[model samples]
Target: MTTTKPRPTGSSGSADDADATYEHHLTADEQKWIDKKKYAWIFSIVPAAIPLIIWGVAEWMKAIDAPVFFAHASWFLGPIAVFILIPIGDFVLGRDGENAPEEFVPQLEETKYYRIVSYLYFPVMLASLILCCWQWKYGGMEWYDKLGLAWSMGMTSGIGIVAAHELGHKKTGFERWLAKIVLAVPAYGHFYVEHNKGHHVKVATPEDPVSSRMGENAYTYLLRSIPRQIPRAWNVEKTRLARSKKGQFNLDNDVWNAWLITIVLWVALVIGFGIGILPYMVIQAVIGIALLEFVNYLEHYGLLRQKLEDGRYERCSPEHSWNSDNLTTNIFLYQLQRHSDHHANPTRRYQSLRSDVFAPELPAGYATMIAAAAMPPVWFAIMDRRLMQYYNYDIERANLHPSKAAKLRKKWNRVAAKQQQTVKAG
Candidate 1:
């Protein structure tokens, strides 16, 4: 809804130059808007409290010792809420296509309300995680139920990391340290190192492991991305310390600090709650990291930036990311689905992120799509067609793994042949 002219190809000039030129083209008249909407921004903080809500319900269920239905399935209450209810709610409530007026963008971005919510996100998340750990040790649930509870805790905590992401992009040291603190919840401190330093530079290209290429399934992508990213983060941090003439082992190494914090958290939980808490913590952490990976898979799956004549990939643009403006999901996820804008202006606050019409649209909210991604056939059937259509059936335009290139080409040819045959029959 924030209408702007199409940007020139990334190869035409530097990315900063493109952004500056784009800003310069806007006229004074188009920048003014009388209406200011601040009430809706409050809903963005709801995700920070989801863990507490889930914990409250779980406690209630235990108090009642509810029937088998609630007792057995209560552990999965968070996932069911997010993946099932949220998607359904999105479809029912529908999307808001309005973008904040241009002049109002700065005012929204500068709000202390947004910053305060982000800052408080950490303590709430930390409290919920401790509560979950306590419940796991003493709740006397079956292994199945315990696993479910741990997973729910993990999933909700993973959303907390989304708050961490918003803070991590800030230029201030306080926000960045908060990012590192929140990341320790999932033992994913490396995310701070890799995502900003590594993924941003190479995203939507084959060089980035986090970016799922055409024909790659989510399962395969998860396995590849999670392992590779840790070392990638470490290496990135190592390089940074070297440039600063600092030792890799020092506090200046953020990766080391995050890892130390993670180790301390785990050790404290184990000492406080006994060895049983260890599995719960580890499983929950794994699930939390997996949730992040699942999102990474969906955000840029099968999209690619073009290579220039000099072999450097074109700078990323809105077209390189799949976006959803689905209102309910966007509110819960902190406008993460407006990912095109986030990548284009990495430091922009979530409340001010605009939906770009030029970005490729997702069929549904991320929660619905994440569920679909679990079924590889369904994911392929939906996304593969979208990918082919986006590239006009030209495989060269797609970022495909070499092993799948020939098979995808053959598949494309078959689709083309079917279309031709249908035309002849007509």
Candidate 2:
């Protein structure tokens, strides 16, 4: 059921309008895509905005002389809102599968308004981080309160990585640089390099650190991803610098230069806010980057690209990535769940990224999937069968965890044999 939206303002014509060469009236579904993403992009800031919400709630609780748990729980609200509430919204609101009409796509891509919406993330994120640092040290809050705040701030930076991911994909220098800067807060500056240079190229292959294999838990993937990503990122930049006759240690290297930003920011925060904030910084960074990698783990979990006759992996297609239509998560992650389209047209802005029906689908949005990924048994129960179904129950087609491969093959063999026998008995 496609609801007809008013065509985006400032448009000369829309799909709703009848044109000279057109044969018939356009249905509401076929109309020019309304720029719902215009305002939805702002929702990504909710994690960063957690402190403001906390302040308002805290003041109200003080006025009412509410229990101490109110203050503690207020800080905890960030996690609840992000993981619990937002996912609820995803289910209730249903899917956002809209795409800009072919005729409208060029104009949609050219629109600068869309670009500006994403750029707003930086200041809001910076303010949230600094304010949280001050409050953690001097706000007269309990130790538990500080931990909640730090974790909440970690969620902010964690989600901010998604913002950086959006900006990083743009061809412009300023946006790319901003991506590096945003990542500095989480000490994941290497993501900008490795993601663009390394992961995208080898995505859904046996080799990609960012892509999770069948039967691999998110914890194992994170353990593998966090350490490997740095050297991977460094190696990418090192090769680039070598081509230009530059030293790896110099500011010209994107890897080191980005790390320099992290070092400077951390040192300044430590000096300004006292060394107690150091542990908070670590707490936040770990949580933040862990959240980022968790997204990575689920995005292409158990999907694989078949190798071609030449022994090169086939070009990545919509089939290689998992896609979701969970509306709230889509808006929160800047349509990242419509990942197949982004990979198909890497430079396409989020506003213009289309949803492909052919892509592999996730059973639910990020929050649900992230939770499942944490517990390997639950994840395997839900995803492994679905993955095998996607490949016609063929284990050979999967990018599998080395340790789990033999067991998985034997298990599936039995399942297939039983199914065949059942058919014969019938």
Which candidate has the highest TM-score of all?
A: 2
lDDT, candidate 2, residue 225?
74
Encode model 2's per-residue lDDT on 3-107: one tens digit a residue: 333222111233333222433445676673476667777676666677667767877988999997776788877778778988999999988877776557788
TM-score of each: 0.89, 0.91
Candidate 1 shows a clash count of 0
Q: RMSD for all candidates, in order, please.
A: 3.7, 6.7
- Ten-residue stretch with the least lDDT total in model 2: 5-14
Cα error, candidate 1, residue 88 (Å): 1.3
Clashing pairs in 1: none
Tens-digit lDDT string for candidate 1 (107-220):
878878778867877887777777777778887778887788778878767887788888999899999989988888888898988999999999999999999988888998
- Superposition-based RMSD of candidate 2 using all C-alpha atoms, in angstroms: 6.7
lDDT of 2: 0.83
